[model samples]
Target: MTKQITDDLAQALWETLLLHSTKGRLRYGDITAIACEFGLTTKAVTRVWKKGIRSMGDRVAAVVKAGWSRRGRKKSLQSQTRPRTTEDLIEESVMLEIMKCGGSNTYKIPHQHKDKLRNAGKLPTTLPCDVQA
Candidate 1:
């Protein structure tokens, strides 16, 4: 069974991250140390750290999917990050269909402007990333 990241733990982690943030960002070294202090993987802690920063940058609430899934035989970082709902899947499909019709559009998906995507209904209002690039 995969360990679940409870709201309380996530909240605590967020607060801890906030305290350690320098100009709204923490160094990766700091992230590793925080993870050690919290008895969590560095990736997990970093996931939370980046998300909080991104949310603030976007002027929205900080949110992330911070738990693992049980279906997978092995627990990998990718699986830990992608926890999707039916509605999310539907939205993604719609977005792909729209993108297919986007003639000569070659924007990198990850780096694309989210507001434009959201305005075009290609992405959801709230985007929770596992890691901030």
Candidate 2:
């Protein structure tokens, strides 16, 4: 697996590359040299530069430019949050009951009961019981 670059190191590398590219477009040899210094592959350095820097066509770019989106799902507003469905509540209560009695085994919750639970979305998959019980 490739080693993950730390945010600080990446930022520093981006800044240094930006400084060098201010004169002219950075060459592959420059990226290779930086890669050697940082113990990263040249491809890794190029990828980082491409991701962090904007407009590869530009001869000069700033490393610390803003506007890159923060990734992942946006937070749902409190009003937009969904309430639990009836099936969800039932599944939760059943799981609590399972934990209370014993996991998947004790109190001998029947296969038919489990099947009913699965139908109601209380269980997602079959358990490892040898018999119906």
Candidate 3:
């Protein structure tokens, strides 16, 4: 009568089978030899081979389904860097205009003059006096 293969024997033989299969040199005789060496039935050896094949198939299927490895933390909004917007550009130009105006008290400049500077891309959104620099 044939003996049942132990877990350790199955694992060892499965690893050996993987090595041989990768080399394209696996055969039924190889399994039979392993079974004989480990005192297991040929059926037991084949069962382990089937289990290994199934495990590999499951892994391949999972990766194929996801299209990539879905591991680790996802990207955060804080980590994302967006391109400068039109509003940001306008604000920067306004600040540059204020600096170019001799750094004098912005409150002293008339609203119409400030508006002209703003149209010329030389005014900040708010005067330095209006808000703390």
Candidate 4:
């Protein structure tokens, strides 16, 4: 499993690499020494070193760009705001009571429900649970 280092640790790692690197390239011995100092695997230290300066810069840039999103509830799409389930599609509360009698309502709701929902541009696959209707 990959280790999850905090931002501070990541920055410190980047700075340590910068100090040890010559022309953004770290020699094998330097990598091993840095890894031992940070208690990280030599492979992990070498992988970051191989990504060159851009990857190192990203570690610092992440701090500068942090908290811009201000974590909160994600915005809901208009069509997705309400449930699209068959039960939820039948908006009229009385429809549930009527549907409970049998497969579909006796007179108007069962007959017209699907057609009304269809013409109103609802998904045909999302028609009410009364398949017999």
TM-score of each: 0.44, 0.42, 0.38, 0.44
Q: Native-vs-model 3 lDDT? A: 0.59
Off by over 4 Å in 1: 1-3, 63-133
lDDT score, candidate 1: 0.66
User: Given candidate 4, what's the lDDT at residue 40?
Assistant: 80
Q: In the order shown, what is each candidate's alpha-carbon RMSD?
A: 19.9, 10.4, 16.3, 8.6
Clashing residue pairs, candidate 2? none
By summed lDDT, the worst window of 10 consecutive residues in model 4 runs over 60-69
Report the lDDT tens digits of candidate 1 across residue range 1-133: 1245766787789989888888886766888788778888877777777777888789998765455544468756985663444355455555554465564455343444555655576866444433221
Over 4 Å off in model 3, which ranges?
23-25, 60-133
Which pairs of residues have clashing backbones in candidate 3? 94-123, 94-124, 95-124, 97-122
lDDT of 4 by residue, 38-107 (tens): 8888777665555446545677442312222556888879986655455544554346546666545563
lDDT score at residue 37, model 2, on the 0-100 scale = 82
In model 1, which range of ten residues has the least summed lDDT? 124-133
Candidate 3 Cα deviation (angstroms), residue 100: 99
In model 3, the number of clashes is: 4
